[model samples]
Every structure is written in C-alpha cells, then in structure tokens.
Target: MHDEYNVQAGLNPRTVREYDEAITRVSLGYKSVDEYYSNSCSCHVVQHVRIPLLCIQAANDPIAPIEATPYSDIKDNPNCMLIVTPQGGHLGWVAGDDAPFGAPWTDNVVIEFLEHLQKNASKPESS
Candidate 1:
C-alpha cells in the first residue's frame, strides 16, 4: 500500500493490485495518476503562496519522509516557515511530564509562535 500510495515511491512504475487504477480514477476523477499528482502536489504549490504559512513536520515521520521536505523553497519564501523537529511521530508529539494528560509539545510551540506574530504585528518598522 505504501509503495502504491506514497509520493516518494511514485518515481518508478510498480505493480498495483488489479483494478487499482480504475478505482483511483473513479474515486478521484483524474484522467491519470500523473495528472492527479500534478494538480494536488504541494512541492511547487507552496512557493506561490502569499500569506504567512507555518508548516510543522517531524523528521522521523514514516508516512512522509524528511527527504520529501522542500527546504530550498521554504528558505527562499518569506511567507513560509518550516519547523522540522528531530523527534515526533506524524501528528503525535507527546512530551513534557504531564503529556499523558496534556496537549502535545507542538501545541505550545504553535501557540508561542502565534503569540510572537501577534505581538510583532502591530509594531512599526524603523527604517
């Protein structure tokens, strides 16, 4: 399933189960798999975004590997910020002593980042 569905594994032609293409086409209404990917992929889409965008990704994510990160584009785009954590699993970033009863560590990080943005939003720039 990973080989058939993962974007990283789409570089080569691999055998999918019978009716896989037909099922995908019917469900998604895409003429071909390549057409679907071309329209839906964010690798090139993020570069065109004009609003502030915060992207948090885990380096150890198995579903979406760290290698798939668009580092150069994020670096060049002022509106984009990518935070790659050394440790985290997909949407699970359990941390702190009270993690079992509290929110994930990412919640704090996101709140802090948003607070910072809000605080600086009204500040006048000095030329």
Candidate 2:
C-alpha cells in the first residue's frame, strides 16, 4: 500500500519498501527500534528539542491526519505549540471571511511569530 502511494507520487516505488525493510531489519537486530524512532521521527524528536517551535497543523488536511500528531508529546515539550486550524489542506490556508487567496494566512502568522521572537531574544554585548 505504501509502495503504491510512492508510485502515485511519480517516484520509483521499488526503493521505498526496500529501504524501509532494510532499516527495519537493522533496527530490530539492534533491539533499538523505539530508541531509533525516538531520535529520528519528528513526533518523538519534538519532545527533546529546546528551541521555541510553532507547529501549525490544519485539522482538515488529508495527507497528514490530525490524529497522528503526538499531542501528549507536544504538550510535554514547553517550547512546542500546536495550532490546529479548522480548515487548510496540505499548506493550503484558504481562509473564509473575505480572506485573500494568494497571501496565505499561515505565512503571515509565522512571520509575526518570528518577528516577536527576534524582538524578545537577548541582544549581544558589544565591546
């Protein structure tokens, strides 16, 4: 099934499964599948990251199911913020209420957040 999805995306499907199976076998041999994923997968990796991270997830996104996002892990990480809007397909911020189509709302929000971070960050002590 995963192979079929890769083919649909115009990629050579043969390599995907082969690579995954190889990695899985190695992980199992090491008896560290959980540890490997904990350090690699974004779901687990996010928990240990110390920087301020804002995750804007669209609730209606089909490719990335809302249920899969590790909410408990995110909550545990003091630096992570999970903002789930009601609508917005993969990176699609087509907001209602006279919202413009071209200027994605998400980009604007991200920009504002970055600016706020810049303002809050401690300045360098120059000689």
Q: What is the lDDT of candidate 1?
A: 0.71
Query: CA lDDT of 121 in candidate 2?
Result: 88
Kindly report which residue pairs in candidate 1 clash with one another: none
Cα displacement (angstroms), candidate 2, residue 30, comes to 18
Q: What is the lDDT of residue 54 in candidate 2?
A: 93
Q: Which candidate is the best by lDDT?
A: 1
Deviation in Å, model 1, residue 54 alpha carbon:
1.8
The digit string of per-residue lDDT tens for model 2 on 42-102 reads 7758788899999999898865668768899999999998899888877889545667656
lDDT of 1 by residue, 11-120 (tens): 34254422334455435776665565456556878899797888899998864567768888888899999999887867878866777667888888889989888988
State residue 111's C-alpha deviation in candidate 2, in Å: 0.8
Q: What is the lDDT of residue 98 in candidate 1?
A: 78
